[model samples]
Target: MSRTVPYQPVLLRLLHSAIALLVFGSLITGFMVYDRYDKRFGTLNLPIIRDTQGIHGTIALAFLCLLPLFAIYCFHIGDRRLIQKESFKQLQEVGKPIWWISLQRFANSLLLVSATFAVITGRMMQEEWLPTGEFNHVWYIGHLIGWLLMFVSVAIHLLMSAKVGGLPLLLSIYNWKIRPEDMPKFWLRGFKLKPSTTFLFFFEAVVIGGIAIAFILPLIFTSPQ
Candidate 1:
């Protein structure tokens, strides 16, 4: 007997892939920044990129721009993939399929939370701080912790997803098949903002506004070198 492949929405694939790539970029450049400036833990002999901090900040800005849409979709349309109210209760059945499912959901939710944490902390930092040997800033420390949490969350997410859905589910998000109704043009027609999602939209707007301010503030209040 042949197994069937699972189908994923094209929108979800696009958002997930873009965010995943940005997250990986941020992680790499973040490490380079750390290796260059704050190697209190240990240092890598990685090739020095003079503007690694700028590169990381640019990637983080892109992430901030895209994350809200992804968050809205996840909370509204893809809620099933995240932790539910009963998720903790389901964890009691260890070694069972439900337990794996719940664990996957928990990891998925953690991924979102940690990503948001990293982005917020990253935005709070000054690009000049790391270069100027100011590594002890609270925001920088929070950003480092956020990076570690995101790394662990992503690992658990992949492992739990593999355990729950095996290869098919792991590959499903990358699948490009799209149903007619799921097309982008049809999205607006089907889109409806419920009372519950209203708050999500408001939150999304606030995050986007904050990102805009994060960009504009540097120009308005330039710190003297």
Candidate 2:
């Protein structure tokens, strides 16, 4: 008889599934909006959606609202696998190459930062600005940058996941074989504060706070009112 791989906790699977769906939806709709509105960077041959902005906005709102819950889960429970202190400690082994799991953690961290930046800058964008070809607006610029970062970050994340654990690990989150012990109720225990949790909090705050300040401060200083 073959041994079954360990099952992901119900809460973690649910949250990860929701986040993955939202991220993909946001990316598709956001690109459609960009293709329709801005061509300075060149345009794709994809079909132009007349209401891309509306679709994108709806997806963005959903993503923005749900992201906090996901963040909470990540900060509270997901940080253990995410922080990868063992990987960092391996840095001392000068001749040893970093493991795929370590690279995966780093990629995941970048994805979180990129997602937060995309959501913040996206919220600051107005529909009128995009339709009027007002691509030069500060928030729009930030949104564009965030979009690029998100695209790259997601690509890296997917690649790293594939390299680290292959299809089984990737599919584990979607598996329906949750054991009796893997119920959602027990997931909270993973959130206990370890030394690594502090590092995760600080990393997220810096990425999010730094981007917010960079874009928001300019508006505050330049406002005519």
Candidate 3:
């Protein structure tokens, strides 16, 4: 019999949702804020974001959309797609249905399409791919909306990732060459550990405290005195 692929874990699901919320929020808001190059936000003259604006937008949209469905597909198999046969060979035990594979590919396609639209539109708005637009009334507001959504999404994403195993998971991205002999009998069963009051601090530090600093710093620094 042919072996099948694996599904992502629960914690990862939370992270994906948070990232999606942010990306969609950012994209829609960005549509409002910087729709024109010579737009102004309050008294500050903000440059119309065009060329590279869509790069982050593209990534945000892709991650926002793809990560969840991928996570869902992984959920059925019981591990992250990051550790799949195509990516990480450590997890060859889990199995998946053919239909799930098709869905995953479709999700990936949506992500690519969203990115292309965001990038293309972003360029057009800035006149990189098209001529600059005359001063429109709506663009000034759109840019602010985009920035707000993006800001919220990233904060939530980071919080969810850190709350569970996002930080450690990030570290493990570079992990390599673990000996099969040295490997535990069931790593997926998870490592046993002591729980503590400190767990709440990850909440304080990431969701509340971390967001405050990451977001507020930019606003403070960027605003004209």
The candidate that wins on TM-score is: 1
**What is the TM-score ranking, best to worst?**
1, 2, 3
- How good is model 2 by TM-score? 0.82
Model 1 poorest 10 in a row by lDDT:
188-197
Q: List runs of model 1 lying over 4 Å from the truth.
A: 1-3, 188-225
Q: Residue 163 lDDT in model 1?
A: 80
Listed in order, each prediction's TM-score against the native is 0.83, 0.82, 0.29
TM-score of candidate 3 to 2 decimals = 0.29
As for candidate 1, its clashing pairs are none
Q: Which runs in model 2 stand beyond 4 Å of their true positions?
A: 1-6, 84-98, 193-197, 207-225
lDDT score, candidate 1, position 79: 67
lDDT (Cα, tens digit) per residue for candidate 2, span 31-86: 88888878789889678777888888888778777777776666667775565656
**Whole-model lDDT per candidate:** 0.77, 0.74, 0.39
Best by lDDT: 1
Clashes of each: 0, 0, 15
Q: What is the Cα-based lDDT of residue 211 in candidate 2?
A: 50
TM-score of 1: 0.83
Q: Ranking under lDDT, best-scoring first? A: 1, 2, 3
Clashes of 3: 15
